[model samples]
Target: MHNPSSTQVKIVTADPSAIGLFGLAIVTLVASSQKLGLTDGLSLVIPWAIFLGAFAQLFACIHDAKHNNTFGMTAFGAYAFFWFATATSWMVKMGVFGSELAGAVDGKQLGFAFAGYLVFTLFMTIGAMETHKVLFFIFVLIDLLFIGLTFDAFGAPEAFHKLAAFAELGIALLSLYGCGAAVLNTHFGKVFLPVGRPFGIFKARS
Candidate 1:
């Protein structure tokens, strides 16, 4: 009989960070289109937010969790929920849920949401700095987007709205970079760009 102890198995998987970076790209592009009025917010924005932003990231989060990649899991999961909430909010605003609920979701409620995302973005920015160039740019743009979003939510002047559009555009561009990096890394099996150690609770498990 063959000795089981003498045999060994090793499984290799793609990088979770790469998957996350790519998802952000698609999410930002669609979000920017909505912000820029290039597409109808109701018809297009809702679907992209739910499908690409929410579902895609959620899928990445599962993989990250399996890898015992705390950084990848939390980062992807939090953003995944963010998109889900954003989609729900949009639906509420559009009266898809009900007129009464739509009326309840006023500017102040949106302001609070913006505030929450601002904090979330800031924390993620720090993590991005530790991740890689593609992710770092995305995080930076996300921080900018939150700033513009918060301002608009607070009933800022029309100028701030314009600023928000620009920020969203920036997000779109950064996301493209992230997407490119993900595809390349997944296929190449090599880190074209070096992303250093994880920050905070981001630890690799054995």
Candidate 2:
């Protein structure tokens, strides 16, 4: 039997969350190390930002879209672009785009970008409550990260930078755990690692 109405009804794809979370973990871990004064220079960080932070998440977002995972797709896609944009901004600041353009860059503008992401992450955090504890924790840390980044960009106290650094580190740790959970759970054909249940606060209204 052939159906012209649709090419294929069943769409199969591996869960992309593991790789997505791994990419996020790698980027944040490296970035936080710099912010924590344990490392220096973003020249080394740029490649990770582009490959792991941007490309890996973008790949996850694409597969997520194929799976019809609206929330996952949008979240991964947004953050994927966020990494790409931030990487480009770093290049500009480093004078890769010429001295004049680099000189014209403003830190406050990055504050605006961070603030916008804070708002976006807030709503997504609510959605994550229904996903799993690991993901929910990740969102919470993301909220904190955005908060710190926004305030730090706007010239807030050094404490804000510290806050962001710690938050980013937390994101990395939780994301690594999430990545492992996603992989092991699916591969073992059982819950090898538990992510915990949803909050159930938003169960469908009957």
The number of the candidate with the highest TM-score is: 2
Model 1 lDDT on a 0 to 1 scale: 0.74
Across 113-189, the per-residue lDDT of candidate 2 in tens digits comes to 99999999999999999999899999999999999999999999999999999999999999999999999999999
**Whole-model lDDT per candidate:** 0.74, 0.95
Clash count per candidate:
1, 0
lDDT of 1 by residue, 13-92 (tens): 76665556556667677777767778765667777778878888898898888888887798889889988988888888
What candidate 2 gets wrong by more than 4 Å, as runs, is 1-9, 204-206
Model 2 error, position 193 (Å): 1.2
Where is model 1 poorest over a 10-residue stretch in terms of lDDT?
Answer: 197-206
The numbered model that scores best in lDDT is: 2
